[model samples]
Target: MRSFLLLSGLFCSLLSFAQTDTLPVFPETPPLLEDVLQDAEEEVDFDFDTYYEPLEALREHPLDLNRADREQLQEIRLLNDLQIEAFLEYRATAGPLLALYELQVIPGFDLPTIRRLLPYVSLRSSLDDFHVPLPRMLSAGKNELYLRWSRTLESSRGFLLAGDTSVSGRFLGDPNKWYTRFKHSYENRLSYGFTAEKDAGEEFFRGSNPQGFDFYSAHLFARNLSRTVKAVALGDFTASFGQGLILYSGFGYGKSAATMEVKRSGRVLRPFTSVNEASFYRGAAATLAFGPLEATVLGSYRRRDGNVVVSTDTTETQDLPAITLSSILNSGLHRTPAEIADEGAFHQLTFGGCLRYSSDRFAFGLNGVLDRLDQPISRTPQPYNRFYFNGNQLWNGSLDYTYRLKNLLFFGETAVDPNGRLATLNGLLAGLDRKVDVSLLQRWYSHEFQSLNGFPFAETNGVNNEAGVYLGAEIRPASRWRLNAYYDLYRHPWLRFRTDAPSRGRDWLVRLTYYQKRKLEVYLQVRRESKEQNATDYFGPLDRLVAHQTLQARL
Candidate 1:
């Protein structure tokens, strides 16, 4: 944890850079985004670049509300489905909005929600120029460049031992961290950029990284190319579909104060500008539209870091000793010989496609994906890992749907692995009245079910071996005060890492927020969670499971 905090401090230089235009380069993050970032920073698996791109882009080119669609509005990350639906319904009946304040009349658009939405949205005439020539678009596009450098004020243990060649675990590079990026983009139509980074104790222009930075990523994305072609991407990018059961890449929200915002929504293909190496794909993808039907296809091939184990025993199927992998490394740190050896040690190939049909009230889709690895994965046998994935090849297929009727909305996804294992998630959102809204979701995953790239709403970390139900509500008692609350109950039928036996858990949260628009904003939040875990006082041969509870309050 100390090392992670140091790395975050290293990024302080990143915020010191100045943009050419000097137009509020990066505004203060909204409350919702701020909360998500705080949670992501605590877990080192996420790349900060993923969150920065969208915010920067929106600041540079605000969305035109009159022309924005459902998906575009959701991209702001500040509005929930209930609000979006209400806004769309209001727009359909009231016609193109003439002013930003017109939103006050829309259902679910309270003062706080409006304040959060103000910066990223604008009221533009629908009759604005619909088409522009390629040359003009290229000449008018925006360009940005950023460079940052940082180093510790004093030498740490890693630096003291770096020069000792006899020490195998010593750092291999200097103590500085460097980052640089260049981006060019036009409105939302086209974007191309490249980012390079070198972490502390990593090689730079020598040793293992003779070419320069230890990691480099580039991408080219274009949308609304033609009437038939919706979007295209080359180089690096991410894909998210349905409710994120089978395939979802990039950052996603789990449990938050906005309880009804559990469903995942976004464009299928988005450009990858983050430094996180493991959560992106390098290749090409395209989305085509035909009337009410749309199709997306993609292919990716990349080398990944992994812990490789070479066996001494010979196998009957081959002349050489068998080679297997114990785990895939995602930290993106290579400061020692052991860490460097694990870098790009294995190859992965992924191919997938999705087909969807949509209307104003409902939508349906089918998704399929295949992943193959050059080396097989073999985990050390353990009672808890009996259901973990092994071998080299995997494939999954799923069906997802969404239907909106009056004030009620329904969404779900059901997926299956090659072995017939099942995983499913379903949810409902209802605007009970002008002052209240409620949500309910239920999920079930077989013990053998596994999703290597899925990040869905669940009690556990991943989307497997869990069954739970969630109920949440949001109430606007008055113009300046609002309340939010939720309760969740879950159980694990199989043994967990710390708990030696089947366990169950329950969690609940309540938050009250006060809003005065631009004047003042404050909130009080309380949460308590209880779950079964091994007891520390037990002296029996077998560990005893006991209920443990945690309580927290924040303002």
Candidate 2:
């Protein structure tokens, strides 16, 4: 009996090893005999109902139509690539879809496909409300069309005319200035639109010079990919390079110096003549990102021709190229507030530069600029002198620090320009003509900031010695409000011409703002300045006050 039992055990062991190697392995031991038998029975009971249950659940909980992409839409098994493309193109041209039957109009979409997709599409306005529903008047695939028209009326005081007329005029505001725009988008990814404006005002008048349609901007663009890359073009657009040292092009509208005047004894006294010039720069810019590194490059050319002085034509043409590179770290030697408490810190270091070459067919100059920003210090400096001197003769550097104190943000920067002497030399050179000798007319022509002739009445060259510290804070008391305050202490040793006098000055600015939904914002600011003068033979005080209010709205 014992021999027979041993032989039987050996046979069973061989059978178990064979089963383990040949079949899928579960745990160390197989399920109980009863459970295994029951599982087998369940597999035999499988039918179409079991498969359709999950499919029905997924269809009832389909993805949001507003944000769904082609892949997600295809997962429903009712749409294909061609159908998706047609739908996207149609929606882009027609606007938001309002009915799912509209999909039948798209190529490749048929009755069977629409019936299969009916349970998974919705026409709700809110993305969160998107859910399976029966067909209704408003369906997900039907496009909606909307049209809008607007007009603006603005009056200007103290407006300056480009002719021989004096700096005084009050004319009727532009009455027929109208704006029209058309936009159509589907799934928020595919979109296209066009906008145009027309104005009938005195400026557009021919013989009598009535402002009518002085300027207009029109553009048409479509977004190919919304998440990663986007493309845009404008007939007349504006952009800046680096810090505006190399390139800055756009339409600028502000108080023109010629139009701005001071009221003395009820008489308007103009400080400086003003010129209004408007033009457009056509260009392209893009940003690329890979892991912790990012790069941005842009290039553009602009042509501006307008009135500078009465009767004298001024035109300038310029080309600019700019690039920037940055590296980010999440831990180790460089750390930021985001990584400080989690055994590491996130930091970023960036280096960027731009160059601009300007020419007017007769004169040309090349301007180059460089900037560097490392952890704890973000430096930004423009090499204006390099462009004027035609070499790398000027350098500016800065060190900045940012520290997070619980819920507070504290930051400061210390900047220095070692090549200030070169700037001073340039100012002196500008005061002299090509003959290298100072001209009497040039003396008076030199402004207060650029004069270096060592005028006996004032120390005109002293502004070259400039060094200062800026300390400010951003305080948030409410979710929609903020306060900013800053103090500046600047010392100019060159401003001190006589002994036993203070040469330092102090200035401060405080601003308060209220923001709501990033759409509406208002701010109030105040500034005060005090300085002593020894070169001008005047020492006590000079102060100025300015205040203004502005408003903006977008739909």
Candidate 3:
């Protein structure tokens, strides 16, 4: 166990520079993204797809700092809400920034923050004419294509099996996974890309999916036109707004070394090309801006694979057939006949829209979404399942806002389901001084609160049957030394998959890092978490419930 934790920490630390080669001028990805994804992968597992479309897009199309608003500034990830507010205020009163180095004078920006942000941001005059001619946009665009394949040496059972056509037989293809992408862009104003991937256990050219790959995605996005259209997407894309209580299609960092990583930031419409097979819009989405106000509308039709059972016993009594599902099976693996049988068994339609208004220090947004399924959903019999969405059609609408006061930035969202069950998430991000920063998030999702596609910042996976509080801080006492820590206390009001009764849990992480120069860094991290789960019978005299404890340190 000691060696396992030590090796786990080293493995993650070594992956820090992995994304540098993905683009022409890709700098070593800031460690903030690497650590955030590592924790998110451990939390949600398969949902943490290593999609680089957005980051690559940003690097190729750097944000012009002088013209960027609160939303555009937030996309930098290195800028917290407090820093964003300060940046806009500085530009408003002092006029356009004379140089990029002016960031050193910003209230909340530290040296490390400035270094991390320099790659994706630029300082340009407001009248620099950021627009591109349509002919040059199409004729002078840059294009890149990438193909990658990977496999494991020690394989799972699906890789080696006796030759048989039975349902229990091995996977149709080898254990190797395949990925390929093609992208075209012109200074971030115009972009079109195609991405495709096959999971490890899925077939290559046989069985249910005869195509070369199990998944394929294509998108074309153009932004910043004359004055009417802010953006447009012909195909697949993702959207995130406010603090992500209503719609956060893009993945944001959770708990990480950067204490203020709590804020979620991305354009309203972004190209989506992750390995996660669900939760993305497939048809069309667009954003239109008119001065201080902006509007967005989107609609999608996609097929998802899940096991579904129609109950005949209740069919005669109701107009719709009762459906039950064990899980959504997000692994994207189709090895055996049982797995293949679940492919595209359920069809769905998702449509939503958002209206946003932005001022110098305040922003307000309204978002609404509707999800319809060909088959109704019924979860396994559990206390937590009582409030889960049941009907084939579901809808959620929310109002989200952000307001700034001095060094503190306050943000929150209030959402409701079709029946009025409510979910609320509120947070505060403040820069105590030049050397310290802190963040607080409190979430309350009613027992019956649900949104089929709503993903918020919380301890649980989604906004349903869970409530929690999170607090985090980052301290820099010197130019080269920094400390980060956070504590999360949460409770599941109803039973979950592994636990038989309601439970409470807590998690905490602390990390220290030192840098001699921008080129050299050394870091140490310690983490501990406690949660309740079903216990084994090995420990005599104990109840069926056990508190799972984990402690790890990396130096």
* lDDT by residue for model 1 (115-134), tens: 77787788755544336665
Per-candidate local distance difference test: 0.83, 0.30, 0.74
Most accurate candidate by lDDT: 1
Ranking by TM-score: 1, 3, 2
Q: What are the per-residue Cα lDDT tens digits for candidate 2 across 382-487?
A: 2312112112123333222223222222222222344432221110101111111110100111111221111111112222344444344444455566554545
Select the stronger candidate by TM-score from 1 and 3: 1
Candidate that would win on TM-score? 1
Question: Ranking by lDDT, best first?
Answer: 1, 3, 2
TM-score of 2: 0.31
Residue 475 shift from truth in candidate 1, angstroms: 1.5
| Model 1, TM vs. native | 0.92
Better of 1 and 3 by lDDT: 1
How far in Å is the alpha carbon of 243 misplaced in model 3? Answer: 2.8
